[model samples]
Target: MSVWRRYLVKDVTGRLVDLPSRLFDSADDGTAPLPHFAGRCVELVAAVIVGDRVSHGRVTELAFTKLYFDQLGYVDAAKRERMIRLMLESCADRRCGSHRQDSHRQGDCSRLAHRAGAARDQLSREFGWEPKPDERDAALSRLDPARLRAAHREPAQTLH
Candidate 1:
């Protein structure tokens, strides 16, 4: 197991990202105390931000949660702004349930996408990563082909 993978724990919350226990203080190494990401959790925050796909709600949740969990950006108004912008850029889907849940009266889908894209310029500097051209396509391309392959290709594996 790679050192990084050891600290990686699947979120029971059912979102598709691997969260770091060190950041959340959920690391359970029996040998000794693990370093916590109380104030320097930039990488973990980036990973979560990157993992945000398919659901605008998840991005919104991550954005709000990072205010406390990620020590690097919450204190800066600009950083917080960029995070909001990213969430907005992720809001192109008119059918997204997250838009309906916004208590702020931001139910307009195109407006949401516009708001999210507002922070594109600051993404790299703030989060140490930037979206690629056609970023959604890139996100889709990251899927593991093996996991998506048909499982019952062989006759014995078929129910019939």
Candidate 2:
């Protein structure tokens, strides 16, 4: 069975771009790149929490993660929901610089916040579920990925 999936990407005009499934398929040996599943989750969250100053860096990191997710077959509903909540939480920052350009505080990625909302909505629509409040803060605060090791995934290589 083919496990095809799609996602929302941001266009130059700040519109949601519907990435097609054909983009996920591999032609040479029929194997796409690995989805850095957890890595993606981390980057998306960082983009919001870190604000606009670091948004580009974080998005760059998540881009690879998204590719890996597509290659590994999309995540389950629960995990997807968790990711959405994080996006929502990050976007809730009141000091979004793009929307408040005059603000003195640094790192205000208001544009990314909007994109996060779009992504959260798209994920919610695709999964047919309502977005719930984030209850992962306490747990997330104590989380440390540096402790994780080899069991997470194998190294990448050419499929063909």
Candidate 3:
């Protein structure tokens, strides 16, 4: 097991990009402490903001949860709910794209888009916002084959 102290730093939440980078670093260590876990929370917030424009919210969220679990190991229902709610709020403005490049070959591209669209709608409803159907579809369509493959190849736990 690798020592995790090198990833530790204090009073850095206000720095946006540095936050996620720190979180990403800590996540690789399996023994990050509670305060470092708190830092990961900061990273999650900043990541939601930075990734909003680039469609990486889900990716960041997965990492956030992993570090959260690493720090606390087990959180009760109330705390877990609060964290999830915070995540949803931070990412409320972002859209997730699930464009499928293999759809044409498999004739299942529409299904992929539909599933992604439905997930988006569920997120919007949970956050008390109307889902933008057309905009989401357009965004998915804009995802080129290369991007889709990259997204698909990402860790399954890294987000949708």
Query: 49-105 in candidate 2: lDDT tens per residue?
Result: 122332211111112122224334343335556656755654565445344355434
What candidate 1 gets wrong by more than 4 Å, as runs, is 1-35, 45-82, 89-118, 128-160
Clashing pairs in 1: 85-116, 88-116, 89-116
TM-score of each: 0.26, 0.21, 0.25
Model 3 Cα shift for residue 42 (angstroms): 3.6
Clashing pairs in 2: 34-68, 35-68, 35-69, 52-109
Rank the candidate models, highest TM-score first: 1, 3, 2
Model 2 C-alpha lDDT versus the unseen true structure: 0.34
Which digits, one per residue and each the tens of the lDDT, describe model 1 over residues 35-154?
A: 333344333322222232333111111211233233332233445566677655544443445534664545465565565455443454455432333332222222322211332243
**Where's the lowest-lDDT run of ten residues in candidate 2?**
56-65
Cα lDDT over the full model 3: 0.35
**What is the lDDT of every predicted structure here?**
0.34, 0.34, 0.35
